[model samples]
Target: MNTADRVDLVTRYTQEVVTDEELAELLEEDSPSAYIGYAPTGEMHIGHFTTMRKLADFLQAGVDVTVLIADLHAHLDDEKSPFDLLDARSAYYEEAIEGMIEAAGADPDDIDFVRGTEFQLEEEYTLEMYRMAAETTISRTQRAASEVVRESESPNLGGLIYPLMQNLDVKSLDADIAYGGIDQRGIYMLGREILPNHGGESPVCLFAPLLAGLSGGKMSASEESSKVNLTDSPEEVADKINDAYCPMGEAEENGVLEYMEYLVFPILDERGENFVVERPEEYGGDLVYESYDALESDFVNEDLHPADLKGAAGEYVSEGIDPIRERLTEQPELLAEAYPDKYGDE
Candidate 1:
């Protein structure tokens, strides 16, 4: 692909790129690497799948992709996944991520999966962390990790080190681009500022847009109905989307439309499939969209009803998630062990 084509591939579905100039420069190189780290904590939902779609984009653009299962970070971040459950959760996360990659129409075998403990314990990495610690003030570290680590009056020291380790991960992994949701912009910006001092190059950052929750506002695992779980059944997905806060002809804060644009449409388009909104003869017949923009335009023009859009979105999302749900079902023991309290009854 030419530079423009390659740049389009990388920046197509992303919310922001650190610098288009830097991305263009990297595209000029023979090979550039991109990496994203996920702390193995909660269920990998449809929101997380959106980032996987970007990973597929990078792969198609000829960038080497690395998936970092940050188990240790999960351990250090107030033990969110629990030390004992880290291995199970990490294993589950890898499988789910691979499923997501495939759902995005990318080959999972082409991607590399790395565990945090693999090299985070190496003396070279540890020494650099100490160097950053010596140079970085506690206040600065807290500021960088503000969005990530939980804040409190007596926050654990691990909270401060979390962002530092994440910063170093780019250098340690030798990645050219740091890909993540926009929330990590703060930490990666700090990484760009700090890494050069330790002889590490600042990574070009690519960010995916955060999708709104079904009920509106941010999507969180804590709010069960707020996000669609990878394992959600067809009925559950339909129910969630149907009851979701989607307004007629209003694009703002519509999670159903967000999924249709970010997750469902991209995957469907890549697979040479059409997005069909089924309706009876009375309700303007079935609206078929070969592109998401068409669907969005119709909705924005008030030609499409919210109910019709929700039904279509649920069906498309379920089709995309079916394989993932089946894959996870084959390994019941993984979820059972990882989230014992939640899945033990099953």
Candidate 2:
């Protein structure tokens, strides 16, 4: 596929489009690089998968890709990160990141991994980055891109430098596009505005919708109930989806239903309502429909109960994890080392 088609596929999957022929032409004449950034600060959760899948899709469409581990940002965000902890637990977190990426079916060769600090310090980039970071005020930086900063209790120097360094990553890589979640919009906008001052064109930003946790809010790696980690077992995924806050007979404005609409529904191509699990013995098995409208109409009209939908969602979520679970089971040693606390208990 050409660049335009590739952009379309990414936009379809992510619903965030950041490419245009004019912009693409400018990038081609200017820098001609494309990359996807990842903050490896926490266990790679289902939330991470949404972006990783987009990154892979971008690469499949022949875009050059870079996946940053963002270790330095992890430390800057909190003093308690695995890197700061400097214990077995910290190393385990790092390994878990690698394992989770591999389990997610990300191509190892396609990813250009880097530690944030090291990437910043390479050549004159580090010195230049420090200078750029110094020019931007804390208030401007905070207002421009401080989601992570606001999330921190005591935003430190690293928190302030985080966006600057991230912006520097785009300039340093000379990338044509940068991918992040909607939460990173402010920082990404900062990159677009500030990067050109340092002689690099601003990378067009693509923001994927955030996936809510099972209990129905932003998924947090720190909160067990708030996320489905990549390491979760199939049964765990099923149970979580089963108990998820998917309101029945309602539109997707509901967070849980929105998760189903954006993440789950798109994966199926057809509407999820079409695949009906007919319980009647006379029916012999489930009845599948080609149109989502029909299925949704049946659901909203009380023809289908919420439990039936949950059952289907549980099965679907379970099946989705089958391959990932197989990879995890095959790497028992890796799992033992990466998740010693959880795996050891079992």
> 217-241, model 2: which lDDT tens digit per residue?
5666677866666667767776776
Best by lDDT: 1
Best by TM-score: 1
- With candidate 1 superimposed using the best TM-score fit, by how many Å does residue 339's alpha carbon deviate from the native? 0.8
Reference-based lDDT, residue 29, model 1: 86
Q: Which stretches of candidate 1 lie over 4 Å from their true place?
A: none
- Tell me, what's the RMSD of every candidate? 1.0, 4.1
lDDT of 1 at 266: 85
Error of 1 at 46 (Å): 0.6
